[model samples]
Target: MGRHSRKGAEAIRPDAAAADPAGRPDVPRPSGGRRRRQGPVPPADGYTPFQDAPQVRGGHPEQREPGGGWGTGPQPRHETTGGQQRSYAYGSAPGAPDQDAAREQAVARQVSAQQAAQHAADGRTARQPAADPGAMPGPRREFVDAFDADPPTPVGTPEARSGAGAAGPPVEPEEAPDGEPAERREAKGGKGRTFTGIAAAAVTTVLAVVVAGQVAEDSAGRGAVARAAGVDRDGSEGASRSDARPTPEHAVTRAPEVKPLSYGEKMAQPYPIAADLKATGKFEAVPGLAKAPGKGQKYRYRIDVEKGLSLDAGLFAEAVQKTLNDDRSWAHNGAMTFERISSGSPDFVITLASPGTTGEWCAKSGLDTTIDNVSCDSAATDRVMINAYRWAQGSATFGPKLLLPYRQMLINHEVGHRLGYNHVSCRTPGALAPVMQQQTKSLDIDGIKCKPNPWVHPGS
Candidate 1:
């Protein structure tokens, strides 16, 4: 048995040696009947070796000796572990460049360039010089020439180029020497001056038009006044006829003959009273005659009575001659004289006719006689047609107390028409009625009553 056990032990020894693959001679092996636990091989110096001693944990790789031992020394940095090297930057790890940081740097460079351009445009000096001398030139003649040769592209609008975008400060326009924006001042002053000129021109035109209208109105008014005053608009007297009369060759040499009579003798009553006169529609010339005793132009006249009337034509002729030769007659003041003509065409004819004939003659003469019985002087026929009814019976307006004066007024009034006199009224109440007044009708005019008058020249 002892021999068999020794041979078995030898065989186990050979198998153990074969299992030791490291071929370490000093290493101890397990001798129990079980197999050895699997483990790292020990060194021949009897020391255990550390595995992957220089390794990174939460931060940088731990410091270690060159022979893979723990030590307290600065460690060498690497871009990558057992791989391609990569560049590193601040706040970034190795193996790849910091794309986000590089992008930020590019944006910052663009912003700085924009700031420098803005400073130059605003006529200010930049604080910092350009980082790259070749990339950007300094402010010099050559740089200015180059810039001028290749001008920058123009912006679409002034607002966009002014840097007033959503993230930039607003730019302001330059001002003129007049303390206002150049463009704003020009717009305001130019428009204001133009408007002022237009307004002034309009006012001047209006004033001229008003003045012209007033001048025309004044001219028309003057013409109307001239016509109303019985004067020609051209400033000349409108005489009824030219003063041309055929006179005797001895008229200048001959002394006027006159027969003067007292007032009582002039007013003497004649035969065949007016009340006894018949109403006649026809007239006959008086036989009596007279000559003016004044040295001036002489006016010839004649008197006639209705043929069927009982009035004496000679007596009526005498009364007319006496009245015309009075100092208060139209011939007063040496302006003219009167002479009675018994025959031929006299300058004026004074006739006595009935009311019907008086109206007929008045109508034919274009005188208004329908309203009341009146005497009229026919300028065209040179006839003074005295109404016989008014002559013989007198007017109801003038009672018997004023019958004589009323007769004188009637003669003067009718004869005044032959002298180019127009109808007039008393200027005031109780005043003398003008000789041209129709006193045979009434002494009242336009709410004013006047006293009776008989002479052409009342003051005389």
Candidate 2:
């Protein structure tokens, strides 16, 4: 029996040696091929069985007996550490303390250096880098530093920098022998100042353009107002403020006598009698009238009286003309005609009369006069050819009734005939008498005076 037991132990010893080269005490040898129970085992020398065991993934113990009395001896060699088991790389050992301690000392040195740098920077002015993080170095940073150190002064100020000033571009500051900061030179290079120059030029151009446009607009407005007001008779001066002008109301207040025609006034008023009669727009009459040809194209008075009149050749003829033109109704109705005609010598022909002669003539003819009666055609002609002996205005029996108004009426009536207006029967009973009515034979019992034909407008 002793011999068989010895042979069996020898066979197991090789197997155990192969399975656990370190002879780990946690594993126990079974009694037979039937296997030993798997369990926690008490170790000799108080060494913990699991103190450095291969780690179980879940760090828990599997159910088993202390002595290896189990189904499988140490589990298959291919088996992985279960949740209850722990493991280690087959031959690796713990690192030496000396190497680890040396690494810790190096880390402490790095930390101390960083803290010292931060403390040194805490009191000084922070340096402003021209380049932010990841910026390139050289001229870009130098220029930025120069600009920060010196800024341009305000323009037009006495404290302003020169056109070529200290803020221009990079200039190295002078240094002391010991490397201390020395006084800086005025920055001189205009190079790399292109951006500033372009910006300044653009601003100047924009301002100049705006100013020029304002000036042009102001000048144009003033010119237009001056033309509209026309050349001042008194030759008044105007205000010179750039941003303001005399309003229309202000300009008008200064000159009451010189009435400026408004657009509305001009539009509402009628056209003048003759556009050129008064070059200066003044309408006063002149003396020393001249003789005119008989052509009706011009304002030449042509009249022919029947022979045998008692009136003075000139005075009577003049009176006849003056009376007819005075009546407003006659003038408005265009009772006078300016037709052209050839001559026959008789009384008088007034020429080159002003444009308002029709009105002037009416006023003149109303004057009282003494003259013999004459058989004259009652009419106002552009030209007057009267017979001194034929008419005999005052000498006749019924001649006294032919007052200035009546004579004027007669003249206007005849002129109406020449103007292509025919005599017609009166439309209204006891209405005013028309200048065209025949009043030579009967007295006017109805108190009728000249009235116009409502259908036609009147004018010279």
- The per-prediction tally of clashing pairs is 0, 54
Candidate 2 Cα misplacement greater than 4 A, ranges: 1-299, 304-310, 327-330, 333-402, 442-460
Model 2, position 174, has a per-residue lDDT of 27
Q: Which run of 10 residues does model 1 get worst, by summed lDDT?
A: 1-10
What is candidate 2's CA lDDT for residue 90? 15
Model 1 regions lying over 4 Å from their true place: 1-280, 368-370
Q: Can you write out model 2's per-residue Cα lDDT over 271-334, one digit (the tens) per residue?
A: 2223212122122112223343132223334433322222233444454444334434334444
lDDT scores in order: 0.57, 0.34
Q: Which 10 successive residues of model 2 have the least lDDT summed?
A: 70-79
The candidate scoring highest on TM-score is 1
Estimate the TM-score of every prediction.
Answer: 0.40, 0.22
Candidate 1 lDDT over 159-225, as tens digits, reads 2332323333222223333346434543443344444444554465577767778998999998887
What's the CA error at residue 309 for candidate 1, in Å?
A: 0.6
